[model samples]
Structures are given as C-alpha cells and as structure tokens.
Target: MIKILLVGCNGKMGTMISTVAQNSTTLTIAAGFDSKTEGNFNYPVYDSLTNVKENVDVVLDFSRPATLDSICEFVLNRKIPVVFCTTGYSAEQLNKIQGLSAEVPVFHSANMSIGINIVNNILKTISNTLYKDFDIEIIEKHHNQKVDAPSGTALLLANTIKDSIEAETEFNYGREGIAKREHKEIGIHAIRGGNIIGDHEVIFAGKGEVIEIKHSAISREVFAVGALKACEYVYDKTPGMYSMDNVVNDTIKF
Candidate 1:
C-alpha cells in the first residue's frame, strides 16, 4: 500500500481524497499536514510537516501556494515523491517546483481530472486542424470561493492550443470595448458562482459553423482519484517532473 502524507487534510479536496483513499485497497493516509488541526481524520493531523512522524511513501498536496516552501523543504529532506494538486502558483514558485524535481519525483497538474487531460490532447488536434478558419475562445466556470481567475485548466488548454499553432498567438481574457476579434488571439473568459465543481468549454467559430468541445466535472472525487493515480505512478520513479499527461499515457499503454 502507498502511505500518503496528505497536506491540507481539512479542506474539501483533502477530505475527498481521504474518503477515496479509505475505499481503495492499495492506498492509505499515513498522516496529514494542515493549519487547521481539529478535523476528525482517521490518521493523525499535524500543523506542519516538520512534526509528522509517519513513514510516508509519497506526499499528496492540496494546500495553497503559500505552503510551497515547507513542502519543498520536506521533499528535499526526506527525498520522497510528491503529487501537487493545488493551483494558483506564481511563476517563481513554479520554478521552485521544477527545481525540486531534479532531486525527487514531482507530479504537478493544473487540473488533476484525467478527463481534462484527455480534452487537452484533443484540443491540440482541433487547434492544429481548424485554426486558420476558426476563431478560438475558452470559457471556464468554478466555485465562487476559488481565488484564481480563468482557471489553470483554462490556461493550460489555451496554452496547448496556442503552442500547437505556429503563429504569434496571444490570450485575450474577456473582451472589452468594440474591437474586432483577431484570428491570432485566443479569448478566455471566467465565470464564478454557486458550487460548480468545474466546467470548461472551447469554441471553434467559423463563418457558418461552430464546433464546441466541453468537459464538466460533476464532483471533486474525479480529482481525488486522479491524484491517487498520480501518486501510484511516481511512487518508485526516479527524480523528475511529471504531469497528468504522463499518467494518462502510461495508462493508455497498459
């Protein structure tokens, strides 16, 4: 069994992961690190990683970006693999994560849902085939409590679409004024309301035809499950950076 040191064990995603892991035959929550330590968890919860005493196989993090430093420190000290499920990290913080991969396996993804990763692959094909004739726009929706705008998954899709096409493409987040839509621009829009698990829609607009590709996450369990799969993928791997694409590709081959 993979013994996971779960960060942010009191949050919604953390609790969901704990519940999912409990049902799995090959996964167990060894311990948890969270600022709020009053939650009734099956495993022990500590306010910080430095206080953890469990023999953990991997660290699965769903905490905020503010916790990156401590997580990195723990990884460096313990030389263990980690799967980061949190979003909204700054470019500098991302560089820190990349650096950590050189010493320990690191799995990071903007959105951990396998379905989103599949959609990402499909968008590459669609963007390459239809960019000349169609204008692309991405709309993403999430819960109101979410702090990030345009969602990282939306940006991931936008970047995937942009990179696939060989042109000077730029992102336009929510148009304004009366400017004509440029063929070289990818429009991104964000919607926040209620308790939306997640929703993303990509539109390819032509003169008379509009082709839309969409993915809707019905529950947080999808991400919790995906994170566990990522943990299993990197449990014994060498030090390196990994993503959901790697996980999906490996599963496809199996």
Candidate 2:
C-alpha cells in the first residue's frame, strides 16, 4: 500500500481524499495535518507538517499558499516526496517549489482534473501553431469563497500557451476604464458566485472562425481524485519538479 500523508486533511479536499483512501486497496491515508479540523478523523492531525511522525511514501497537499513555505521546509528536511494540489502561488513561491525539486520529487497542478490536463496540451498546441494569427483569451468561474481571482489554472494555461508560442502575449485581467482589446494581449476573466466548482473556457479568436475550448468541473471529487492519481504517479519518481502535463504526457510515471 502507498502511505500518503495528507496535508489540509480536514478541508474539503482532505475529507474527500480520506473518503477515497478508505475504499482503495492500494492506498493508505496514514496521517493528516490541518488547522481547520482536528481530531475529527481516526488519524492524527497536526497543525504543521513538522509534527507528522509517520514514514510516508508520499504526501498529498491541498492546502493554501500561506502554508507552502513551511510545508516545503519540512518535506525537504524529511526527504519526503510531495504532490501539490494547491493554487495561488506567486512567481517567487513557484521558484521556491522549483528549488525544492532538486532534493525531492514535487508534483504540482493548477486544476487536478485529467480533462483539464488534456485541455492544457490542446492550448499549447493551438498556441504554438497559430498564436500569431489568432488572439487568446481565458475566462474562469469559481465559488464565491475562492480568494484568488483569475484562478491559477487560468494563469498556468496562459503561461503554457505563451511559452509554446513564445509570442510575449500580454495578460489583461478584468478590464476597467474603457479598456479595449489588443491583438498582442490575452484577456482573462474571473467569475465568482454560489456553489460553482470550476468552469474554464479558452477562446482563440481568428479572422474567419473563432475556436473555443472549455472544461467544466461540477464536483470537488474531480480534484480530490486527481490529486490521488498524482500521488500514485509521483510516488517513486526521480527527484525533480513536475506538473500535471508531466502526468498527461506520461513523462512522469510510476
């Protein structure tokens, strides 16, 4: 069985992962760490990863950005493999994760859905092939409780597209004061409302035909289950940084 130390185990994802682990013969949800809900599960829950005593095969993270530094510190010191499912990281924070990759396996994804991974690749291919001829735009919708606007998935998708095209596409989020569209700019829209899980649409505007792609997630289980899939994939990977694309492309496999 793969021993999984789940961070943020009391959050929505934590609860879902715990429930999934219970039914899986190949996985064991060994321990958890969360400030929000403690002592609610049979496993021990600490406020930080430092207090975790189990020798886990891998760690599944679904926490916020605020806890990233501490989690990295603990995981690096312990030489533990990690699968990161959290979002809302700055470039510097991302660099920190990159730095940790030199010592331990680290897997990160903006949207854990396998379908979104396919969408990301499609965006990359389309951008590489026709970025100069078409304009790129991304719009995302989330629940009202999500603190970050323009969800991280949108940024990751935009960045992947930009890198693939190498077109230096400028990003514009939420227009204001009579702003107009620019061919060289990519517009990103964020919508927040009641109970929505996640919805993302990517539009490629061309002269004759406007091609659009979309991915909709109606349940948190999509994310939770995907995180588990990541855990299984990255369990014995070589020490390095990896993304959902790695999983989708079969570049990082168990």
**Which candidate leads in lDDT?**
1
Model 2, residue 174: C-alpha shift (Å): 2.0
What TM-score does candidate 2 get on C-alpha atoms?
0.93
Task: Report the alpha-carbon TM-score of model 1 versus the true structure.
Answer: 0.98
Q: Write the per-residue lDDT of candidate 2 for residues 1-254, one digit (tens) a residue.
A: 99998898988878988987888887888888888654569787787677788888888888889988888887888787899888888889989989999999999888899888898887766787878788888999999999888898888888888788775678888789988788888889999999888999999989999989999998888887788889888888889987778778885232
Give stretches of model 1 more than 4 Å off.
Answer: none
The superposed Cα distance between candidate 1 and the true structure at residue 109, in angstroms, equals 0.6
Worst 10 residues of 2 by lDDT: 245-254
Candidate 2: global Cα-lDDT? 0.85
Structure candidate 2, residue pairs in collision: none
lDDT of 1 by residue, 178-231 (tens): 979888899999999999999999999999999999999999999999999999
Each prediction's number of clashing residue pairs: 0, 0
